[model samples]
Target: MAKYKQLFLMGLLLAIVSCEQPSPPATAEAGKVAFNITSYLQQQRQMLETRQPMVLKSVATQGQEPEVVETPDIDWEDELAVFEQADLSRPSLQEFYTRQEQVLEDGSTAIEFTKLEGANPQVQYLRLVMSPEGKLKQLHARLEDKNIIFFSRRTINLSTNPQTGDIADYHVEGVQKMVLGDTLRYEVKANL
Candidate 1:
């Protein structure tokens, strides 16, 4: 009788263990990265800080002459922040954009990401040109945001020195319109 009781308890324990629910599957999709734009920009920022290169900046607005300046003391982070906003590597945005890659005739690689239909992302398009050695040659992005009262759109282009992998020039052009105020158009270009 005692032997029978021990066998019953063992069978009961096995049954309970077998009935436990299985653990959920790992999230493989969340780990996918189209491009690590944020990390790349951060690295560029650090390099620029160390080099402290002088920038020849030009700014122009509607109905106004362009203003140009050359200075070594400027906020690199702030200047680069606009590019950072186009980063699409966030987990939440993984499904919002589609990526395409191709090799150009000059042996460079072009990777582009475009927003999918019905997906309202701030960055509508992004393209990156990489050299044969996998160095960034150029970057371009278009961003747009609209609300009931205001609308804004910006296009950014950045070029890097092939030999040194440093930013050689960049341009930012945008338009802003308010419900009750005049439309504003501006352009900013910087050469390093």
Candidate 2:
């Protein structure tokens, strides 16, 4: 019967529509970001393994994500507290790298960066603090002396060699905050 045939076709259509797969979270734009993050991570790991002072990155991030997306919340001051307790007497420099961890959606992620031995002089180091959604909370960088400086730019990022003044394209607010010693603490937020 025509009525039965129509019902069968409708059911088939519904089934097909419902079978469609959801889009991947890692889109083309996100893919580019993932590539950059992976590259940075690899380079950081290499530096840690080799005990090298990473060339200061000139900028922060270059992402394809829409500018309107909500910036994730971060508590940079607390993040900095961790580095304050950094163990200077650790046997190897990489030991500092190993102590770094960031919370991801599923579990947690570890970030690596290059640190020069006594050449840089500050015992404390920089590391990435993260939110549960894999967004960066704060950025940690080493200062030449035994102190670290931080700024309260809630939704900003920096990418330049403060000492050398080499400019890199970092998408952030340019408000400087004083952090003494050899560590530089930055509050990296999701928003601009």
The weakest ten consecutive residues by lDDT in model 2 span 29-38
Which sections of candidate 1 miss by over 4 Å?
Answer: 1-32
The lDDT of model 2 is 0.38
CA shift of 155, model 2, Å: 10
lDDT (C-alpha, whole model) for all candidates: 0.88, 0.38
Residue 144, model 1: lDDT of: 97
TM value for model 1: 0.80
| lDDT tens digits by residue: candidate 1, 28-111 | 433446566678789989988988888899999999999999988778889999998888877678578777889999999898
Q: Tell me each candidate's TM-score.
A: 0.80, 0.23
Backbone clashes in model 1, listed as residue pairs: none
Error of 1 at 11 (Å): 13
Per-residue lDDT of 24-130 in model 2, one digit per residue for the tens? 74434221221122334344345434543233222233342323333223233342232333323233434333233344564534343445444443433445544
Q: Please list the residue runs of candidate 2 whose C-alpha ends up more than 4 Å from where it truly belongs after superposition.
A: 1-3, 15-35, 52-151, 154-192
